[model samples]
Target chain A: DAGITQSPRYKITETGRQVTLMCHQTWSHSYMFWYRQDLGHGLRLIYYSAAADITDKGEVPDGYVVSRSKTENFPLTLESATRSQTSVYFCASSATGTNTEAFFGQGTRLTVV
Target chain B: GESVGLHLPTLSVQEGDNSIINCAYSNSASDYFIWYKQESGKGPQFIIDIRSNMDKRQGQRVTVLLNKTVKHLSLQIAATQPGDSAVYFCAPRQAGFQKLVFGTGTRLLVSP
Candidate 1:
């Protein structure tokens, strides 16, 4: 079952510390996305990459940064963690077509202390 | 900000009954809509999708209906089972945009 994987399934860090969540997909889908799930707010996009070295800001990119660097991997970094940024983060990818059925990774739950 | 949202926060249904989950979107330019089911402690799983050109599409025991005029989308599950319990989310994608704007989600509780 080589689909998508996320590292550090659960993490706890200090408010001012830096943390990075890693995402990798075997599909080489060409489009990868990072999203955060919060109560009442649903899933908010943090960042996405269309291809290698092509990244763009999403709806909630203020406290986070993302880079593609490689087509198979997309990593999200929290330069300075905050309590408000503590939420379950998910990574997704979709093929390049109309039936671009996006697939999601198991998600990483982060707790900012 | 205006976004894709669900009409209900939760829905309680019994097994063997029909379940209908509704979502509302404000993006009129959206051309593709999808339904995803997410279980506890896991990421969302793709269920089904319907394009703006079609009003209905069906799959194994699941059907997705889209109404462009009202900007509404609904997922209908037939003979619901306990395994069908999960948070359902609706996501819509605008033309030329690969990213999807997701709805708030509706939690479905299927009781046996």
Candidate 2:
């Protein structure tokens, strides 16, 4: 509705396959981020978009690609899914990049085999 | 290497008892801190937040205490209930960055 949403609540793909996870926010936030959550690692940022057509790498960006064509949509793509890439992915958005609140969507549980 | 960490991985408390979760941060430049509550299979939901300028901030049933000298933060829940059982995470927002470094998280188990 008015908050952020992630597509494909659960996904299972084979190794070497390409898959994309979608995120959309209705709040028109200026910042959107993708994070992967794993045991003992908490949440590691994969990529973040400050605005449309502007993106930057975070702590863990290898093997993952992200693009934001529009302000409301930020999608993460895995060119070649590996077993190590299997983890829960969360998408979040904030109105600004500094000192602002972030709203998260229901996570996407991806399993690569 | 700035990092946020939790003191306990899991905590068990009886219903109606007070619950406390502690977190340690390594960044003195962190100016803002937040606490989130996450249930099984769900994303983290914001609970409370405090700024570096303040030592304590209180909400309905929760309180956040920030000690800048030691770079420590804590979340105290008053009159814990069964619904309070969830994984609690502390995140500190580093100045000049959008990233909010999250803690390892503490699982609170409230037994009724």
Choose the strongest candidate by DockQ.
1
What are the iRMS values of all candidates? 0.8, 1.2
Off by over 4 Å in 2: none
Task: Please list the residue runs of candidate 1 whose C-alpha ends up more than 4 Å from where it truly belongs after superposition.
Answer: none
Note the residue pairs that clash in candidate 2.
none
RMSD from true fold, candidate 1: 1.0
- Candidate 1, residue A1: how far the Cα is off, in Å: 4.8
Q: What is the interface RMSD of candidate 1, in Å?
A: 0.8
Residues B9-83 of candidate 1 have per-residue lDDT tens digits of: 999999999999999999898888889999999999999998889999999999999988999999999999999
lDDT tens per residue, model 2, A12-70: 99999999999999999999999899998888889998899999999899999999999
Worst 10 residues of 1 chain A by lDDT: A93-102
Which has the greatest lDDT? 1
Could you give me the TM-score of model 1 versus the true structure? Answer: 0.98
